[model samples]
Target: MKNLIIIGARGFGREVYDLAKQCSGYNTEYIIKGFLDDKSDALDGFENYPEIISSVEEYKIEENDVFVCALGSIKWKIYYTELILSNGAKFMNLIHPSTILNTNAVVGVGLIVFMNSNISNDCIIGDFVTIQGYVGLGHDTRIDKWSHLSAYSFTGGFVVLEEKVLLNTRATILPHVTVRKGATVGASSLVIKNVKEGTTVFGIPAKILNF
Candidate 1:
C-alpha cells in the first residue's frame, strides 16, 4: 500500500482525510502516514489516524509518498504546493465521492473537490485549485491555477477565473464574465462583468472594492 501524507491538519485537512477514506482505490489499501502541521501539538483528541510528521520545513519528502495540501485559501495552497513540488514531493488530487464531475471536465493536478460540488461538462480546473462544498460550476467554465471556489458559490457557463482568483461563499459569476488574476469576489456578490487584475469586488452586480 502506498503512503499518503496531509500537509495541513486544520478543518479542511480533516475533511480531506475523511474524503480520502471513501476513495476505495486510494484509501482502502493505502496507508495514511500522518500530517505535517505547525500546530500539531495543539490539536488534542482528534480521532484521525494521522500523527504530526513535522513542520513544513522540517519534514522530509520521499518519492514514494503522496502529499495533499488540504488548504482552503488560494494563497496558502499555491505557496505550499510550489514548495512541495520544488522539493520533489508528489502532489495528489483528491475528489470526494459525493461530488459530480462531468465526463468532459478536465481537472489539473493537486486539486481538492469537496462534497456535493457539481462540475459541469467541459469545465477546466487548473492546478492547486480548491472547490468547496455545494459549489456549482457551469459548462465550459475555466478556473485557472490556485483559484478557490468557496462553499455554495456558482459560476455560469463559459465563465473564466484567472490564476489566484478567490470567489467567496455564495458568490455568483454570470456567463462569459472573466475574473482576472489575483482578484477576489466578496461573499454573495453577483459578478456580471470582467474584473481587473488584483482587484476586489463586492455586493450585487459586483463593483470594485479594492482597486
Candidate 2:
C-alpha cells in the first residue's frame, strides 16, 4: 500500500478522513500517514489513529508516498498542493466510491469527488479541485484547478469553470457558459453567460454583486 498523507487537520481534512475510512477500496490501496496541520490543537484528539504528522517541512516523502490537500478554500488548497509537490510528494485524487465518472472523462490528480457526484462523458476535471456531494457535471464540461462545486450544483454541457471558481449549492450553469477564475455563483443562481473573474453573482440569472 502506498503511504498517503493528508494536509489540513480540521474541517475538510476531517471529512476526507471519514470518507476515506468509509470507502474500503481507497483505504485498502493506501496507508494513511496521518495529517499535516499548523494548528497543534487540532492534533489532540487524532494523535492515536492515523498518526498526525506536523510540519510540511518535516515531511519526508518517499517514492511510494502520495499526498492529498484536504483544504476547503481554493487559494490555500492550491498553495499547499504546490508546496507538497515541490517537496517531491505526489498528489492523489480522492473520489468517493458512490460517485460516477464516465469512461471518456479525464480527471487530474488531487481532486476530491464527494459522494453521489457525476462526471459525464468528455468532461475534464483539473487538479486539486473539490466537487461536493450530489453535484453533476454535464458532457464536455471543463472544471479547472482549485475550483469548488458545492452540493447539488449542476453544470450543463460544454460549460467551462475556470480556476478557483466557486459554485454554491444548487447553482445551475447553462450549456456553453463560462465562469471565470475566482468568480462565485451564489446559491440557487442560474448562470447563462460568461462571468468575470473575482466577481460574485447571485439570484436567478446571476446578477453581479460587489464581492
Candidate 3:
C-alpha cells in the first residue's frame, strides 16, 4: 500500500482523510499519512492525527509517498498541483466505494470523487477534477480538467463544463447548457442557458452577475 498525503488540513481535507480510510478497506491500496498544511491552525481540532508534514515546497519527496489536493478552490488546486508535479511528486486518484461510474464513462488521472456520486454513461471527466459527495452527472456530460462540482449539484444530459469551472452546491444545469472555462454557478442556482467564459451566475435563472 502506498503512503497517502492529503494536502490542506481543513474540512475537505478531513473529509478526504475519511474517504481515504474507506478506500483502504475498499481496495487495500493506500495508507493514510496525515496532512500537509502551511500552518497548524487547521490542525487544531485534528490533534489525534499529528501534523506529519508541511507544504510541497518544504517537504522532502519520499519514494512511495503520493498526494491528493484536498482543496475546494480549483485555482489553488492547480497552483499546488503544478508545484507538486514539477517537484516530481506523483498524484493519486481517490474514488469512494459508494461512488458509481458507468462503464462508458472515461475518467482521467488524479480524480477525487466522493461518496454517492454518479458519473453517467458516456461522461468524460478530465484530470484532477473534484466531484463532491452526492453530485450527479447525466449521460454524455463532459467535465474538463480542474473543474469542481460541489455536493448535491446536478447536471443534465449533454452538458459541458469547461476547464476550471465551478458548480456550487446544489446548482442545477439544464440539458445541453454549456458552462465555459473558469465560470462559476452560484449555490442552488438553476442554469437554464449557456454560461460564457469566466462569468459568475446566480439566482433562479442563473443570470450572469460577474464576468
Candidate 4:
C-alpha cells in the first residue's frame, strides 16, 4: 500500500486531512503517514492526527510514498510543490468522494477538490489547483495551474481562470469571462468583464480595486 504525506499542517492542512479520510480507498489502497512542515508543533493542538514527520526539505522520499500539498498561499504552494517535485516526489490528487466531476472533464495531477463541488462537462483543471467546497464550475470552463476557487464561488459556461487566479468566497463569474493570471476576485463580487492580470477587483460589477 502507498503511504500518503500531506504538506503543511495548518488550518487548510487539517481540512485536507478530513477530506482525505472521506476519499475513496482511504485505508485500502493508501494510508496517511503524517504531515510535512517546517514547524514541528504545527499539529500540537490537533487531536487524532499523526504528528509532523519532517519538513519537506528534509524528508526523504520512500519507494511507496506519495504527497499532496495543502498550503493556502498560492505563492508558497507553488514554491513548496516545485521543491518537492525537484526531489522526485510524486503527488496524488485528493478529490473528495462527494465531489461531482463530469466524465468529459480533463484534470491534471495534484488537484484538490473539496466536497459538494461540481465540475461540469468539458472542463479542464490544471495541475495543483484547489477548488473549495460548494464551488460550481460551469461547462467548458478552464482553470489553470495554482488557481484557487474559494467556497460558494460560481462560474458560468466558458469561463477561463488563468494561472494563479484567486476567486474569493461567493464570487461569480459571468459567461465567457476570462480572469487573467495573478488576479484576485473579492468575495460576493460579480465579474462581467475580463479581469486584468495582477489586479484585485471588487464590488457588484467587479471593478478594479486600487490600493
Worst 10 residues of 2 by lDDT: 43-52
Q: Compose the digit string of candidate 2's lDDT tens values, residues 130-184.
A: 9989999999999998899999999999999999999999999999999999999
Q: Which candidate is the best by TM-score?
A: 4
- What are the Cα lDDT values of the candidates? 0.87, 0.86, 0.89, 0.95
lDDT of candidate 4 over 53-78, digit per residue (tens): 99999999999999999998999999
Q: What is the lDDT of residue 44 in candidate 2?
A: 68
Q: What is the TM-score of each predicted model, taking all chains together?
A: 0.93, 0.93, 0.95, 0.98
Q: Positional deviation of 6 in candidate 2, in angstroms?
A: 0.8
Off by over 4 Å in 2: 43-49
lDDT (Cα, 0-100) at 21 in candidate 2: 68
Ten contiguous residues with the weakest lDDT in model 3? 23-32
Q: Give the TM-score (vs. native) of candidate 4.
A: 0.98
Off by over 4 Å in 1: none
Model 2: lDDT of residue 33: 75
State the displacement of the C-alpha of residue 73, model 4, in Å, after optimal TM-score superposition: 0.6
Which of the two candidates, 3 or 4, achieves a greater lDDT against the reference?
4
lDDT of 3 by residue, 105-181 (tens): 99998899999999999999999999999999999999999999999999999999999999999999999999999
